[model samples]
Target: MKNSAVRLTFLGGVNEVGGNKILLEDFNYNVKILLDFGINIKDYNDQYDRNEVPNSIKELVKLGLLPEAEKLAIINLYTDYHVKKNQDSNDLETNLDGIFVSHPHKDHFFGLSFVNRNIPIYTGVFTKKIISAYYKCSKTSIINNYGGLNWKLFRTGDILDIKGLEIIPVHVDHSIPAAYGFIIKTSGGIVVYTGDFRMHGPLAAMTQDFLNEIKNTLKILHQQENKRGEIQKPRETKVKLLICEGTHIHKGAIESENNVEQNLEQLFTKHPFDFLLVKFDRLDWDRFRTFSSIAQKFRWKFIITEKDAYFYYLLNKDEIHESMKNPNIIADDHILILTQGTVKYRWQEKIRQAIYKEEKGHRLIKYNEIKELDSGFFFYITSLRKDVIEKLNPNFRGAFISSSVDPYTEEFIDNNRTLSRFFRKIGIPSYRVHASGHAMPHHLINFIQSVNPEYLIPVHSDQPHFFKTFFKNSKIKVMIPNKNDRFELKSGIVNGSGVF
Candidate 1:
């Protein structure tokens, strides 16, 4: 007999904002897939820090860090090293089909470092490129090495058929490029998983495209329902389940991408600093582009670290979005790549070779020698590299601009506090000018109503139960799952009642 239900197990990403890992299993087709295997920031921080990482998969399992294999039931997910250390005889095989990554954020894809290399990992074209470039250039190979993993790339509108299931990847606007949401067709019904998205970014039109596609999907599913001679009302919902991220549930106002650029420009115009020290996420090319254009307006030399230069070279090599393309590292004169530290990695050699192919000498700058330069310069540095500011001329008026996501975890809060103290000790003022990568509360409300899913599952949120209040009067049933809870979908409805 064919199984008529699809089982959804919430392994992670329940009442938290970051680490997202959900398991989907099709019993009829014998297919099992993980939506996104991200790390739980608090759990990881409790056990280890940046300097220490789990040495083996067995260690992670022993510490309750990775998913419980006994609960998942699938086999062959670990390496030989783990199997050798395992006491159970059933731990010697692998059954995971694939892992679908929504984006290249550390919380979304960083857990790949622990996954078995044989299973295929799927991502958007640019997501693959960005992740590949990051692991290649980063010195911390112990944490994010993804070299030998099976990588499969997809684009918007491409339907991926795994066994008897079909998954369609659609572009969505977020802080990083190549972010996507999945429209999955299972034996049970049609399901939609909304990855982290926003409506206020420069590429908001892409998110609209996703919305329009979902509406179209609703029409098609409704037509099919009628063809099956199923007795239903005309106002029946078409989609079975809608998995959403409610990161900013209580926040009503959102800072748009344009607002970030305008605020930075206005702030700098009012209080002119001799030099600007800007810290932003490396994957956020949108923020980088904003700073790059600001450099042109002020006619200041934009300096990036070696890692940023490597990312620049990698992204520029691909056919990227129009808004992300500017201040070419090879063709532009105002852009300079900074070299620091005496030790050079294998990736740095490739960057030097690429940069040397176009220009001779003026484009590359030494780290210690930047103090000898004039006042008009924008230093694009990371939070870890704040010491670069201490090397600058003490008398040169400088201000620090933080253009990254707001603090959520304890580690992030502490890091920001430490950064502020360091800036205050040096007599340099620090300013925060950033836009969140998640959607605002109103936008999420509109999104849920537009889809009108029969069941709504909230993940990647600090207050998942707040969704109940958001849709109290609506017909949609909100399902707030606990970690490791199993929910089954059958006949276009979920098998569980409202949690709250």
Candidate 2:
């Protein structure tokens, strides 16, 4: 039977940040698929009014934020509760075939509860564990009835066949641990979807593996088909469209690896403080490693919260214990500082009870283990959540370290200044000492040249036009898709002007 042409439509995450939704359809039949269901948090905040009537997805369509729905099949849920809470009620009512969660990041997978309970969710084991933790802490029973929802666990290289569509999950490097990119195969051709990624972390090797796979898949498909034939020949591997991210396209390549390490060392060496306080995104394992290395070299005790310690355990249990072997590394009073978040509250209580009962007393480090006279470094791995920082006010002191990228905006800077003022009021000198997780423009150009995809569509960025500069000399078709714009794939040519 002759196959139908495939169509891809972007609903969000096209020209701006947040609200990443896309629709895939087979023109010859009634099959439809959705890639991501995200919400624009910034937009929501701007239009929010508690006294007004709840907005619906249809209402969002009126605002040109969402696509007009025809038949919704598969919906990949990739957003958080904050966005979903403000979603028009009608949007939440759209039934879906399955929910493909990328990771546990609030911006990527926090909006799952807004959907119906019967839809199946495809995710990895690590993602499941994190989501479970999130649920436990939030006391949200949305995921408690797992019996009603099908939870499919898939690792890298696992191929899932749903209806007529084939999905292969490929692990990618990101700030979060359980990040994944996907390759969707249909009757038309293969579509590579890179959720979000970076190249300067432990997952670099994995990213290379995924790139190799894409290259191999495309090569095999080319070998089996003759492009010159009047009737397109069947190919072993065929990629009809490449849906990629352009998060940092507009920014110049900021040398991160060596520069960040050097910056950290220089700051620590120059500062003459008794206690060094470093702030970073807890999920960023690379930054964590950098901070730990600096702390160890300075002969300062590496202090982190028990909650962050758990994540460290998950990412690098061997390294954590190995560092603990050094007399300088301490867990109880000397090393691990407990945070007062809902997630940490339960774990802290449990550890406290065990310490009080002396059941596992040896596991707890004594105050004597810490050398109060010696200059020490303290690492505070946390988020921008106001509540988290408010609770951290008492113990955090001395030189402050920011090992994460701050949002770039005048308002964001003002807010950060307010935060810095607050920290200064508490006597801590704050500084930013972090690296980015997205590839810079030059790095992205190198990647595009290496992969050499026939077609490239950039998403997850505000400056999609920047791609034009990098591909100026190339013959490959470069397209900047807009929200609700449709692209048909069949004869190796893209159809449609794309939504503006």
Candidate 3:
């Protein structure tokens, strides 16, 4: 503590694909900031524990769902579901600077529900819309129930000054929209955090722009040697610590979103699918655009869940994307809205209360009505449903394409196997044409080489050690910190300790 050093702590995403929780503290400024407060993706089934979270946030900490932080806060506003404590501000008065959310994925922002109301959250504009959509659709949304967030939303290039720390959120391409990597300036020097990004997506230029802006702090190129060992190029940067994500660090087949789109077009053309049931992550708006385009091209009726319909409507206002404003898609004609159950969810019901009559339930297609459409229809669902498919077409000979996550992990393999059997029973074949949201191995190497950081701490991957091999030829140091371990960044030296 004698010299200026930033204390870094890895709470959750040390050696896992998801659940990223990082704490960065500057002793000189007495500033603490938590980055991407995510929960374990595999732990809960994308829902707050109906039993524990309703009772108390303390139970969430005991179950390892919420991190046991120094100070915490909980709210019980829903009188019917849980006891109401409308006024409780224990950790709300803490000195925590703010929380920075990378994106809208549950593994990134799910923990927002438990965050103290007083602590501000910084994120992208569209990310707020995505979170809002999820909050509306999900009945048991713990975090969204906070009613309104104390957010200082920003665009990609906007520089943020919280306390003494300077945070620059750099928009990056991920499976979902409004994702960003942060270039944070600390008293120790500069900290670079690549929040689950890739370079091959359509937004590769944005990543390059980020690199160019951080060029002073990060060397933007790497030189590889042949058998002759010839030096390639000189590198320069002022980056002291680089906390990067290695979700796809290991050797594997990785495809870009463009590649997936091309492959899906071919798949749809090859199979004369009367009805194509596509399953993807709900928040992946890029994937939604891809399917929307495909449906338009094929002249097929595109059916989206009610949740996505509202999100797309909201995204159009801010983004002004052509797909979002596509009358054929959002007008309830070519694209239809499908909600779960016979009645509307809370959000849907609220929409009906609006003064507009035409917008009330325009093209709200019933699940049973799907049987009337013989062919030329594409339906997007979170999961494939056999009953829905049977109702649409009893003979159901179309193909079901899964364009979200690939079957690389054990969990996905098992889930896909079970889904394949279900499809098989109804005379349908399942195809997986996916573009990973994470960076590819070569991209990871390129990132390490470009940043050329003094130390590279890998998180959010099962194979963190795989990065050592990639950085072996370079001076980039790869260190995998254990869960809850603290690494100090001082005098350009990354020394590890037990915990803060």
| lDDT digits (tens) for residues 15-40 of candidate 3 | 88778989898877777888898877
List, residue by residue over 156-184, the lDDT tens digit for candidate 1: 98989899788988999988888999988
What's the best-to-worst order under TM-score? Answer: 1, 3, 2
- The best candidate by lDDT is 1
lDDT per residue, candidate 2, 209-295, as tens digits?
Answer: 778877776775566555545237564444566778778888754656557789878877777766665665555556666766666
Higher-lDDT candidate among 2 and 3? Answer: 3
What are the C-alpha RMSDs, in order, of all predicted structures?
3.6, 6.5, 6.4
Model 1 stretches astray by more than 4 angstroms = 1-3, 81-93, 228-237, 320-323, 341-343, 409-414, 496-500
Provide the overall lDDT of each model, using Cα atoms, as 2-decimal numbers.
0.79, 0.60, 0.70
User: In model 2, which runs have C-alpha deviations exceeding 4 angstroms?
Assistant: 1-3, 27-31, 44-95, 139-149, 223-238, 257-259, 302-334, 339-348, 351-375, 379-397, 405-418, 424-427, 497-500
TM-score of 1: 0.92
Could you tell me the TM-score of candidate 3?
A: 0.85
TM-score of each: 0.92, 0.75, 0.85
Model 1: weakest 10-residue lDDT segment is: 81-90
Candidate 3 residue runs with Cα over 4 Å from true position:
45-54, 71-91, 140-146, 216-237, 319-329, 339-346, 350-362, 384-387, 406-414, 498-500
Number of backbone-clashing residue pairs for each candidate, in the order shown: 5, 9, 1
